[model samples]
Target: MSLHADAWSTLASWRPDYYTQEALRQAFLGYLAARPDACQRSCAAGHITASALVFDAGGEHLLLTLHPRVGKWVQLGGHCEPSDSTLAGAALREATEESGIADLRIDPVPVHVDVHPITCSLGVPTRHFDVRFAVRAPRGAHPVRSAESLDLRWWPVDALPDEDGELDMMLAVLR
Candidate 1:
């Protein structure tokens, strides 16, 4: 199947309750179904993407990307391209590309999957069905900023800045 077609099929196959809650899942699905363009581009067009939450041993330190757009400390991730065969692979690719980490190991199970509306720099509305994975970086591996981020750092999980609801949710799931 084509990338777009596969995305649409994946979205259609998701049970409403399979997401966080019945109401939330239904609402999101309903919104997607309402907009044929969004549905088509998001699912069928292969615009869906994934991310990773890389944690240090003991899970006390969290790896975060200094997003160039938002200028906030956030997880490493980006759009899923055709090269990525699965959501996990896409997320891992983003993690490696953004962080410059070569030996990263991502947990197969998704820690969480969040779908939300995003307006990029061009002010175009797009949906992000972020399949968040848990990953571990080799000890002493320090990530350098690529074009996607301004910096990369390991922050104490408890000392994260108070911003971005998605980051909070990601941390909660990691805990």
Candidate 2:
């Protein structure tokens, strides 16, 4: 099946835990149906972005990136690339790229979905239909900071930033 078809199937099969999540899932499906280039960065209307909450081997620490533009410690993820064939693959690629850790293992099942506004590099405001999954780092994995982030660090899952509701929600589902 095509990547676009695969994405639709993934979202269709997901059972969200909250009303908002279900709404987002439906909205994403609708967006995909309406826009053939939903996964492309130039999709202007809106695009599907993939992200992953990466945990260390012990599962005690989560790798977060200090996003330069948003100025928030967020998960490793970004726009879907043309080479990506699946949402899970996009999320894993983002995790590996942003964290500079190539040995990460991503769970194919998404843990959460969120829709939020973002200013694209082209200076256009667009919504990102974010699909989030859980990914695991290799044992003794040490992360290097990539150019995409101002800094990269591992945080205790319980002590995540209070303002990051997305992280909180993800942790709630993961735990």
Candidate 3:
């Protein structure tokens, strides 16, 4: 199946843990149905981006990147590429590429979905329909910074550099 079709299928059957998440899932599916190019960056309006929130093996800390574009500490994720076969693959790929950590494992099911506007590399204002998934890094894994981030490190979940409601919501639902 195509990436777009795969995303549709994934969301179509997805069972969000919260009411708000369920709403986002429904809205995202509607958006995809209306915009066939929603999975590609060339859409010129908005596109689906995949991300992973990487938690330590013991779940004590989560890895975050100081994103150069957003200038804030956030999860590791980015725009979907043509090489990615599914949204989950895109999230895992971004996490691996940005974290530079080996033996990372990603949960196929999404943890959250967010829609935010930004002036992307396309040089135009657009919305990023971000799909977030939970990932776990190997014990004693070390991360190397990538060009996409100004800094990358593991932060205690209770003392994050920035407030991430999405993470909180996911944690509440998962735990």
RMSD of each: 4.2, 1.1, 1.3
Q: Is candidate 1 or candidate 2 better by lDDT?
A: 2
Model 3 lowest lDDT segment of ten: 162-171
lDDT for each candidate structure: 0.67, 0.89, 0.90
- Which is the winner by TM-score between candidate 1 and candidate 3? 3
With a 3 Å backbone cut-off (N, CA, C), the pairs that clash in candidate 1 are 4-44
TM-score of 1: 0.74
- Residue 56 CA error for candidate 2 (Å)? 0.8
Model 3 regions more than 4 Å off: 164-166
Rank order (by TM-score, best first): 2, 3, 1
* RMSD from true fold, candidate 3: 1.3
lDDT of 2 by residue, 22-73 (tens): 8888989999999999988898878889999999999999999999989999
In what order do the candidates fall by lDDT, top score first?
Answer: 3, 2, 1
- Which lDDT value does model 1 have at 14? 50
- Per-residue alpha-carbon lDDT of candidate 3 for residues 4-114, written as tens digits (9 for 90 to 100): 998999888889878988998999999999999999998888999999999999989999999888888898999999998899999999999999998899888888888
User: Which is the better candidate, 1 or 2, if ranked by TM-score?
Assistant: 2
What tens-digit string does per-residue lDDT give for candidate 1 at 59-88? Answer: 777789887777678888877675655666
